[model samples]
Target: MTDPISIVSTAMAEDTLRINTIGNNVSNVSSVGFKAQTLSSKGDVHSDLINNSDGRLLRTNRKLDLALQGTGFFVVDNNGQQLLSRNGSFSVNESGQLVTSNGKFLVQGRSGPINVGIDSFSIDSKGVIWVGDREVDRLLIKQPNDSMLLATAGNYSSASSREVKDGYVVYQGALESSNVDVAGEMVQLMAAQKHFSLMQRYFLLYDGLMKNGINQIGKSK
Candidate 1:
């Protein structure tokens, strides 16, 4: 059996981690395509936590501003490394390449970076990119088989087992809002702090009781 101090100590540690995650969510409340993380447990034992959820789509009415309407991610080229993101807010660079908010180039058709020379561009519901009267390239949108494979890396998420999704729909002139619920995260933050404090008090009380009992035994001897 576990000691009272041990139980409370473990609980306090878990509570601290949970509180930090909640704080992160609160901080990113206004960030586009931000997914709220969650801590999960088994019975009375707290274990792994993960953040991966669909965010609500918000209209920005800007042409380059894009959002996924279904299951898919807009691929980006950060330097030479490929990254995935749900944040479709994109802009053209000086070289005319489509880039994400973080300055990563947007991966387009033929698995290459896109460079539409003109500022005038429009994306249809099918993820096709059109400039003037010609279709330059189609946007590279992919989907992962599992949500667990998606993990936060810098300003975006990395995925495994990714496949180009042809059945996905892209929404032009919009962006996906962060899924973090500000009120809910605030409530969770308060509750976690309360639990941590209560656990600390319990641990202190247990330690005091043990100390008193030890001193009494020593005096009797």
Candidate 2:
């Protein structure tokens, strides 16, 4: 027989994880180019697995900022390692190189980071950088179909391999808003709370049943 306390504890832990996800979504509601992360809860084993996908775009007319119209990610150097992001909140670095808000260098092509040679430039739908007369570099873009695509920090990779769209469009002068909705999160919070309460009631009933069983045994004795 399952222990009543153990069952309750496990249920509570899962509920707590769900609440944490809701909280994170609410917190990043205003983050630029921030995609909403989802918590996938099945039977019990993979309780709080998170899924990160690109969100819908919001138009903010600002130069230096960019957003992808379809399946593509902005390449960035998070310190030394490269990272991918849908957040097009980019700006010129101190060296006048195009970079993310956190100063990560944007990746290009199949080799390394793309160099924005000029002091100013523009990007087209095909992600070709136009610095006056020269096409500097094409942005590195990828599209994955299944669980093989592992999102590390913000970069994605897979063993089976995913195809990349080297010429995807990039909208200059705009930033994508987070896909999170406060109202939706609130609804989710209520549902999770009600379910947790129901589980708690079930746990209490099981405990009472075990106690009554012991009492009946004692009386028979």
Candidate 3:
């Protein structure tokens, strides 16, 4: 059988990780396209993170803002690396190429990186970019077959080679709100903290009992 101390220590460690993940979720409640993560344990390991819920769409009324109405991610090119994201708040760079709001990455299109070149354009529901009456390019959207393959970083995510074409509608002038429920996360955080405290108290009690037993044996000798 596993030692009592080892069992309690493992449970305490799990509680600590749970509290941290809940805190992170609460902090990102207002973040755009942020997904709420939950910790799951597999066998004796307690570090499996999963996020599969979709957030609510918020209307920003800003022309460059975009939101996905279904399961999909807009592909962005950072240097040569492709990153998937749902935060569609974009801006044009000096070269007239559409990029993220921070101008760090270029938005990918069907043909490649799209350059509007100082021309006014609009994105339609089907992810098609239109300049006046001319069709420029279609946005490249993809989704992984297994959401577990995605590794999230802020509003962006990445997968190795499991991404496939996804059919999701795009809404211009909108953004996806974070899926985190602050109140629920706070409740979970408090519970995890209480569990950790209880485990610590049990550890102290066990240590004290062991010390008493050792002292009694010494006295007898």
Best by TM-score: 3
Going through the candidates in order, what is the number of backbone clashes in each?
A: 0, 2, 0
- The C-alpha local distance difference test score for the whole of candidate 2 amounts to 0.67
lDDT tens per residue, model 2, 1-221: 97768878788878878888888768878776555555676777543333454466666778677887666566666566545567777666666567766674555455566667555677787777778878877766665444423254334444333436654567877776666778988999998898899888988888899999999999999
Error (Å) of candidate 1 at residue 147 is 5.1
Q: RMSD, each candidate, Å? A: 2.9, 3.5, 2.1
User: Residue-wise lDDT of candidate 3 within 33-71, one digit each (tens)?
Assistant: 777878889878665364646788899999889898676
lDDT of 1: 0.74
Candidate 1 clashes: the total is 0
Better of 2 and 3 by lDDT: 3
The order by descending TM-score is 3, 1, 2
Q: Estimate each model's TM-score.
A: 0.85, 0.78, 0.90
Off by over 4 Å in 3: 147-153, 161-167
